[model samples]
Target: MSVESVVAAPVAKKVPVEREHHGDVFIDEYEWLREKQDPEVLAHLAAENAYTEAQTAHLQGLREKIFDEIKSRTQETDLSVPLRIGDYWYYSRSFEGKQYGASCRCPIDAEAVGIDAWTPPQLEVGAEIPGEEVLLDVNALAEGHEFISIGTVAPSRDGQLLAYSFDVLGDERYTLRFKDLRTGELLADEIVGTTGGATWSHDGTHVFYQTVNEAWRPDTVWRHRLGTERAEDVKVFHEPDERYWVGISTTRSEKYLIIGLHSKITSEQWLLDSATPEGEFQVILPRREGVEYSVEHAVIGGEDRFLILHNDVVDGVKAENFVLCEAPVADPSRMTQLIGHSDDVRLEDIDAFRDYLVLSYRREALPRVAVWPLTESGYGERRELDFDLELFSAGAGSSPEWEQPTLRIGLTSFLTPMRIYDYVPATGALLLRKEAPVLGGYDPDEYVQQRDWAIAGDGTRIPISLVWKKDAVAEGPKPLLLYGYGSYESPIDPYFSVARLSLLERGMVYAVAHVRGGGEMGRLWYEQGKLLSKKNTFTDFIDCARHLIDTGVTAADRMVADGGSAGGLLMGAVANMAPELFRGILTSVPFVDPLTSILDEDLPLTVIEWDEWGNPVADKEVYEYIKSYSPYENVAAKDYPAILAITGLNDTRVLYVEPAKWVAKLRDTKTGDSQLLLKTEMSAGHGGVSGRYEKWKEIAFEFAWLLDTVGLSGE
Candidate 1:
């Protein structure tokens, strides 16, 4: 018997709740959905799941087929290029039918040193390499847990102690544990509620990690000794201000332990000498309101220096574009410009090493990597790695050593699979390490990738990247999946997706709307799309969709919009503002209740988010502005497009209640009968399902629905 035969669609009971802010009142009818512990809430969620399953029952075959296509195109068993750190070459391998990968490392002998060390040792997909020590087998850790996430696994300086953190549920809170490599046994030490990473001291006796507050914000840094109980861990540093979160990391040079406290607009760093495990942390440049910067320890001309990538003015000149400067480590305020600010380049980050410095930046709306050679006289020539592809992403890979000459970089494009290469800066040669294996005879030349622009509402140009099979369409409108996430300064860079081929092969064009809120253009681009200028993000996406229609790329009736998290907020806003523009909308863990969420300082990460979305609770003006655009608050009684809202039961980032309440209101208020579905992942969190196989199924479910909505579900 079919599972859907006995289950029926849910009808949520509406209980009006009046929420007041700034002399204004909001009557939220579906507020009862927020009662997560209520029996009715669970029943409603289950009913919704059952209804979604019933409605899409016919797509089951298609979903499995799509999942199979994804599996077939991807190598079931694969091993990553081994990265050398200290005396070991570390790599991870996935086995066929396993949900997780196994982390392994092999010892480095004399033959595997020097230039050859830069190149990764190639191993067959399912073959066992000699002298490989199993560091952490995630598949074993995930044996019984329905949802298991290996947060961060970092080995100590001597590579004898392994500090790893894992989350059994979807909640971001992870439990950190230690393992002894020599004894091959789990240590007695364990720390709970960590944010998932540990920074080990140079001597490996103490490890620094961040712990979450009641609001789930990592607001405190604690240092733990190797053999002590977790309660004995010292609170090394605490960020009292709720607006800022704290993190700890060791510099690439292994010279200092940096405890960074930052919010959206402001940042402050405290540096502690790595050699002195028990020492005071000194502030490096006090926090400034608008100025933001990052520092890396470097040695140039036989003098100790700090490489600062900042938006601070030098002397009397203002640096609109972030400039690269060098300063004495003792006094970082006394700075001299090394790389002057340029309108063309947006300096992103600097990875400093003993031999050279690798800069990851963006130019012409594309990511670029450059190497600055170190010399006795001063810093030598700065060389930017060249790429032949029109639109691709290239950035530094896992080059962890301080004195390594060759840089490891990763490159990918819309049509190209991920490629790892070793760039020898001295010789100006890029040695190909490995290109991602696409098992079923995939060809990059069979597809097309393009970078197009659309004129936004305020005359600003927004970039849109498009990819589709070559013979899919030559003229007229066709099925197009327009994806966007224009918030949090997160750029949706072009990369290969094995699952996306299902859409492309089925005559669906995939497009990414690089709207203003993203970091694609520059700092100003993000500045314009946030806070008071936030509406530009929604209008920019609308303009991109209209541009697609105007250019005969796709018709409005054949288009579907997709975004998640902050982008899911974009999806809600655009759906409310322009319901007729899209045939359907796909939102994952949508943050639709922004006004309610940001106003409540108790929610996870809400206070820290005030910098991104202004503090609505204290300021009436900010309250009004956010309330005006908050998707859930702004939902009106109008015809709307078909919408599928997906959420995780344990999502701490954007609660499942946001989407649960959103769909209930939409079903009750929207005039159209276009399908409105909600699917809550019972055992997942912000990232949905944890395992690769389950995740692939979830992707197939969403993709199949998209194909069905766009009339491309037919064989």
Candidate 2:
């Protein structure tokens, strides 16, 4: 169980592959790892896993202790708040030993009406309801498979038929299946190779689904009759542009079927009446470069209209953060401004219902929700749902029913477990339905959550969210773990985690760096940290680390940095830029070889990413710009912090080879004797291990390494 037993790290065979782009040629010694099916590649990955296991064998007890702490804090047997759709109230339940949740529903009380009817039923855990029926038990489906993921669960308008999709492999593609809820039998109709979601026709005779192209982009929508064969399904819509991916969904009103086509920045929506299953779809707005819009069906002032949330130029002024407009159903081009754009607030989404419209937005770097009433007269004044917490996130939750008088809003913070509320618009009452159970008798007052700022090189103030146990920092400069994800306008909001308590109890501080490239501070924040300005993300993170050190929160030697996916790319970049700022770096499925990947058109999601990273293949400046900072290309023969890179063999988004090549290059080049390890999950995908227990183990593995690197492994 000693590190000495692991004789040496796995040496990846050097098979030089030349990649030339924009008159620039680069030799990649580990490019041969990209051959996923090759026996040699698999053997190398196995060897890497073996080496990682041996190097960390002594931490087995620590990992198990963390995992057990997570398990004990979580309520194993629980049921979700049942949502009323039609004649039934649907919910899911998880048993103590089950790896997956069971989808179930019970008949709604016909006697209840109005607000009473809209309220979600409070179901007890491990209790059976009268006339309850199990729709899909994922645990049963996952019995023989090492990994199983349920993608979409859609029931017919009448609640008699269920159409769902699941993936046995960790890959994104799924198989569509239908279940007869009344008979408790599965239909003979089965469709494979779909993107995992389906929209049903009003009459339940047909369902529309999407399939991916060669590059794993969902580009084609197909319509399948309930009793028809897969080959008989008609291709209803297809997007030929590789930059745009397509998806199909029905609005909450169930009045219109929408086919949404989107790239990084631009979007176009096609609409079809739900009543007509075989009708052609009409584009509400043609595809316009740099313009994005989403449509929702709304009945306003006794007239059918389409509420369009868009970022288009109005009166020669660009609505960069988006504005809401209403147009007649017959002519969507004639727009009437409803909600104008604001420089301070970014309007993210508007969900239209029969009684009201829910607005989800971001302001002051916190998520906010507002309700606007819709009556026969006109729209009422918007009411913002305010909370007392300054460092918390609040937004709309699951509200599937169109006529429901109550809106489901979820609120949480670093110290608060998720609390679900039913907001009654008419009375302005927030009814507390349920809060996620933390079974360890945890106290929110025992933890401290605060917001701090770091000054970037360009004078931008990047926000950092810090959370630690009240007693952990009394002695000053405790071990700190800094987490970051700054990409694709995706904001990592404040939320509660049960597993995080393990770190807090052990006297550790957890902080999140709200750097640019995220939508935390609004659209402009994202704009400043993407493409040519991506270096800002790395620099901003380093500045945040320095800020923590300067403020006496933690020293460089006591800090560890962690990020995953696009955030994983941040970890790699920062490790190369400022290795001295931390004792360890943990990256999951890191995009280290960006320049090489983006230059190859054959790679999955390369074309769609051009808007985010710039078209490196077609532009010499972009090629050189990416090569300058790409972790793999810039890795030097210098000392580095301890590094642990985790990846999945079936990850289609960030290929496993990216991290494999990254680790191989680091091991071969880096000067330090710091322990470098790569652990690839053989049966998982982008999200890692599928089962809850397995996922807990994965987190334990990472957290344990973090603790050990920060000199608190025994704790």
Write down the TM-score of every candidate: 0.98, 0.99
lDDT winner among the candidates? 2
lDDT value for candidate 2? 0.92
Error of 2 at 260 (Å): 0.4
> How well does candidate 2 match the true structure in TM-score terms?
0.99
lDDT on C-alpha atoms for all candidate structures:
0.89, 0.92
Deviating ranges (above 4 Å) for candidate 2: 1-4
Q: What tens-digit string does per-residue lDDT give for candidate 1 at 459-557? A: 888999999998865468989999999887788899999999989988899999999888988777888889988999999999999999999999989
Give the alpha carbon lDDT tens digit for every residue of 1-715 in model 2.
4555776999988989888887888999999999999999999999899899988888999999999999999999999888888899888889898788889899989899877888777788766688888898999999989999999989999988999999988898899999998888899999999999988998999999999989998999999999888889999999999999999989898888999999999999999999998999999899899999999998999899999999999889989999999999999999999989899899999998888999999998999999999878989989999889979999898888888888888999999999989899999999998999998799999899999999998898999999999976648787999999999999989999999999999999999999999889888899999999999999999999999999999999999999999898899999999999999998898889998888888889999999999998888898898998899998999899999999999999999999999999999999979999999999999989998998999999999989999989997
Q: What value of lDDT does candidate 1 attain over all alpha carbons?
A: 0.89
Off by over 4 Å in 1: 1-3, 6-8, 314-320
